[model samples]
Target: MNTDPRPSEHASPCDAAADWFVRLHSGTVSKADLRLFEQWRQADPEHDRQYRNVCRISGAAQHLSAQALRAILKQDAHPATPQQHRRLSRRAFGLGLVGACSSVLVMGVLHRQGLFDEPLETYHLQTRRGEHQELALPDGSILRANTDTLAIARLYEGRRTVELRRGEVFFSVARSTRSPFIIDAGSTEITVTGTRFNVSRTDSAVQVAVESGSVEVSGGRWWNRRTRRLAAGQAVTAYHDAAPEGIRTVDVTNIAAWQRGDIIFDDTPLALALEELNRYLPHPVHLDDTALRSHRISGIVRSGKPEAMLEMLPDFAPVSVHRQADGQIRILPR
Candidate 1:
């Protein structure tokens, strides 16, 4: 139902893939763009590989400053000799840009930096509505729990496991080949040796998004186990009674913006955004107009501040917020 330009036949694969990446992130990706991307990927194996590499680089770059990014790009563009390459590599390693440019080499660099070699500790964590918490795991990994979430970590001789009883949690796992970190979210199981990712669970569905590194998502009934390998910028959703959806590329930067105390809605359905915002608000928000539920809205609202989110609704959509006598906020057509 949407239209977009296709990559030129003569363009370099990496350049074409980069263009597609920019277009997709522009917040207006059409089905036509997706089809064109698929065609480009199918036309050459290198296209798919380059696209994945670009995604990894972009994910890693999210943590870097503008000046650091410019320095890395400059070094990459004009490394004249072997010595220059070596110098650039060292600079990259020092700036943590090595992982963005090359994952294979960054593993050794990370080892030398002692990122994954640390002592372990067991922990149990939870947070109520309007609350957020950061936790350091036994293996030096980090966990950020969102509102109304419950999680338990158990580290044993052979394995490390976390049970996400409810709500959402983001993990920055430390590499441990001897004991892979596993998260159990209802009917879904996610296994990762080292990665940054987010997991959210509801009564009907479970969702997983990989920000960096990789994870194996496996779940379903015992008789029919299904699995998917998700790379950086990829996400998967599975329902209790349905097969897991295929991997989909997403804006990893926006997936868990709540970690920054903000929630972003990019043309998201009013009903869905309201549902998410309600998780952080003590007073529930209700919709009086069923028609307004499906209306699209786009904005960034401060997390845990329902009033701020409610006040901005009219700026983007044909809706108004009214505070009821019962202390609940109701949204209706203006």
Candidate 2:
């Protein structure tokens, strides 16, 4: 009986697989190189398995933002000795580049060697309930996050993209001819060169109100994309799984009053007003009666101090506020 090991079970193919994986992502692989890679991959079963393992390991790391990868690499800045480099390389192949330490070292070395192109920096910003935050972006743009807002900004070399994960944000974009400021709010995407606008994203809808300059709003699915351009004082709403609403004129000053600790409602429904107010209070305000939802409210409500607003609500409408045992405030008909 022959006691020889099969070629597919050998370790040499795994080593070659790792080298090919690095070369493929170097951004300079030619068509002939890819063809040769395919031949090599199909030559041995072990080669394909190793390639798939490398892919699975790198998939999760790809989701990591460029900033996070850089932060990980910054933790170890000293040049690795020849022995350490070889050890790390061996560990990278053995671990399939899945471990955090091995992944960081491999990515860092690949980046320095121009084998991997770095992606854009991604930043996550959020504000708690009843809180507000202001940020100055690297591109000189200003962002004012409202209460309970969650946003992610990805600043690439050619474009600046901000995704409004939840709630509302007011953006004062700086002028940049080379890079456009884009915001992805749920289903809608608002793009502008340099404009001031407010993007509010709810559970089922997104609203974009342009305060100054112009913006292009695009929504709907990938196949049937809908787009509309809005100028100053114009607002647009896009419902989830629905078409974009017609642009309407709005009072920019009243819409943006929340930035100054005030919530202005001009013939707005009571339910909508309550929803906006609840964003700024620890305890949410709920309307007990369905009919009370249609009550039109037109006034300036103070933020952070919900007691005054609750007190004045009874005067404006025939509704009473009840403080529940659970610290929630319910509005019902008197």
Candidate 3:
């Protein structure tokens, strides 16, 4: 007596098996129901094959939690009853189906890259949700990349240069007055010899915070270039598509605390705080409303406290924080 289930020649068992596949794995099916399902599947070899194929489809998507699956289902706008929902669950959990969906997302991104070309060896450096990193360069320089920070190093000629694509970094220069270090943040170019300073590239402007030593920041129209000398404790901002703003003095240690795996928000905006917090951990943190994000917040957040950081946020702002299964934090207006 072969226990292998074959598909029914009289009726289509594939669809039914698919529904069962999801229900069986959902931890709700009773032992009696499971026995019945097994009996039905083992009735024929075709039934067995059909059920296995259906299960295969949903197995690939196991990384998606039940909540995410339900969200996707809800988006379909199908008025599905609880029983019908169970029927569709198998397709939702199948690995092959989920992988196929991911492929579509990747294809969309790649298509946007170019019509017939793709980038070669894309480099990315990002801080985790609640983590920060102090990257030491080969040239003996140090980069204190803040939370949710990313910098791409591009080598050219005798000079070492880095492009601050997003977030902030404190560069500690080593003595090698010969090879000058340059950092490009948006329209601004920060040139340094043997100095230490912080550089942040936000959507609004590019900021330079100098610590030890000095640096020359230059930016403006392609033809007209303006430069400013920033001394220790001095900071400057260069606006987008505009000239360099005047420089001012600030606490060097407070601005460079990310290097020590800490974020000090001195009445800073909530949105900015979340952006800084996203650097260290492997999770994402999102800010919802501009008004709520603009609220002032002051606190000292240590590393590896993503939950604690989020819990403290409500005290400063009228917002709600939710944890996603993929380790992402969602902030919404209360």
**What lDDT is obtained when candidate 2 is compared to the true structure?**
0.72
TM-score of 2: 0.59
lDDT (Cα, tens digit) per residue for candidate 3, span 1-334: 3122322344456545644554454434466767878888787797787776665444222322344333332233334445544434444455244322222222222222221122232234667444467767666777777666789864444456677888887788886676677787766788888898888876656778888888999876433447899899888778766778787778877767765666676766676667656654467788867777668888887765645778887887788888888878799988
Per-prediction count of colliding residue pairs?
2, 0, 30
RMSD of 2: 11.9
What local distance difference test score does each model get?
A: 0.71, 0.72, 0.64
Error of 3 at 102 (Å): 41
Model 3 residue 234 lDDT? Answer: 87
Q: State the displacement of the C-alpha of residue 162, model 3, in Å, after optimal TM-score superposition.
A: 1.8
Query: Could you tell which candidate, 1 or 2, scores higher by TM-score?
Result: 2
Give residue 225's error in model 2 in angstroms: 5.0
lDDT at residue 195 of model 3 (Cα atoms):
90
Error of 1 at 95 (Å): 50
Candidate 2 lDDT over 13-109, as tens digits, reads: 6555655554454434467778888888898797788777666545433233344444433355644466656655575666556422323344455
Question: Model 2, 242: alpha-carbon shift in Å?
Answer: 3.1
The RMSD (Cα, Å) of candidate 3 is 19.8
Top model number, TM-score = 2
lDDT of 1 by residue, 213-249 (tens): 9999876653344789999999887766455678888
Candidate 2 residue pairs that clash: none
- The lowest-lDDT stretch of 10 consecutive residues in candidate 2 is 1-10
